[model samples]
Target: MLDTSTDIRLVKKAIRGSVDAYGELIEIHKNYLYRMAYLHSGTEDAALEIVQETILKGFHSIKTLRNPELFRSWITRILIHISIDFHRKSVPSIQIDENLPETRSLGISIEERLDLYEAIRQLPEKYRLVIVLKYFDDLKQDEIAGIMNIPRGTVAAYLTRARKELRRSLKEGYLNG
Candidate 1:
């Protein structure tokens, strides 16, 4: 991961029209963008397309970014918007990818992870987004609020409700299984 200083430098260069610097910045964050997109869209193809759109949009608007250190957040906001727009324009289809990376270090079995993802998929869009941004991306609530253009208190409320719903769903699944 690039340090904040390096990201700031690259952002400055990109703002000065250095395509190479911009390319490097995108490369550094590509995996994160892909993961975020995939979590939001639930399909590899949609994730790839969303990432591509995010790259293009970021490239065009790099100069408009006011804070260089917040590049990740800014680009992430773009990806989220694109993902939401993509979903709105297309028929919603949720398919679990069997080859999702293992989280054994976190002591989560594949079956459990799949069940959690399925539960997340069933959530409303705002709730799902909060859960993904908070848990999956490890973003702070304030950051999530900024990215989603919602109040911080709203982010907290959504997170609380989302977690509650997820727990209920997972518990029911467990009991039913």
Candidate 2:
């Protein structure tokens, strides 16, 4: 995460066609962007492609950004667009090696993590985007609304519905599988 002042400086420099500043901004946000893309696509290759496309699109349009303060959100919006486009064209298929040892984190087993990820992937696109943007990307409702081009209230509503559906799906999965 970048401080407000540094972000402003970087945005200004990037807007001036400073590739180094653009590179710095990308370096700061790339990991989080990759994680979000990976969660959405469920494959490292697709995630990398999404990130790459996002960089290309963002770089080309950086000069058009009116507000430097919104740089992160703006770039994130680009990434979301690319992610949705990629998802529409590709069926996410990541094969897990059953023989490999699964690591545990925060009391959740790898299988449990995979289950949650699969469940999210199965959600309707609107609900899935809202859930992923809100939780995975740590974006606020207003930010998600801006990125999705929806009303803030709509974002809130989608999040509420998504959480309910996720709970139901997890419960069913636990009972059956």
Candidate 3:
């Protein structure tokens, strides 16, 4: 397997003018990109939309990116931007705690996992985005910062806030039950 850094180099070259190189880069990162989208969007349709749009924007804008080694984060940044655009145009509503399940079925209950995803979805977008990328996607803080175009400190802050909010949400769930 090509090391990730090696792949980035090839992708950079392809983005400049080499279609074959760009194609190879896409082949490598497409699955990861889709997964990242799916995790954040919480629906297959939105995830699929982000993935398709991200790839298209990446091709169109790749030449403007200076660091070839940062393609994963860069592409993710594009995906986030696309998602933000969609969110802004989406129907607005008051922030109510959304309905959730009560179990998580890995020997846990289905309701637990549903509750988890529901709580996560309730997080303010910035905090939720960081948590999803950091925990669900297993990305490092630095990488997340790059992807979000925020400082590492900001990413840490968002993560802290997200956890606190999630804990409170779950506590409320317990109380209500």
For candidate 1, which ten residues in a row score worst on lDDT? 100-109
Question: What TM-score goes with each of the models?
Answer: 0.89, 0.85, 0.81
Q: What's the number of clashes in each of the models?
A: 0, 0, 11
The sequence of per-residue lDDT tens digits that candidate 3 reaches over residues 52-117 is 988888888888878777777777888888877766665543232233212222243557655766
Mark the regions of model 3 whose C-alpha exceeds 4 Å error after superposition.
91-108, 172-177
In candidate 2, how many Å is residue 69 off?
0.7
Model 1 clashes, total count: 0
The residue-level lDDT of candidate 3 at 16 comes to 75
Q: Give the TM-score (vs. native) of candidate 1.
A: 0.89
**Candidate 3, poorest ten consecutive residues by summed lDDT:** 94-103
**How far in Å is the alpha carbon of 133 misplaced in model 1?**
0.9
| Model 2 misplaced stretches (Cα beyond 4 Å) | 92-107, 172-177
Best by TM-score: 1
Highest lDDT: give the candidate number.
Answer: 1
What lDDT does candidate 2 reach at residue 60?
A: 99
C-alpha local distance difference test of each model: 0.83, 0.79, 0.72
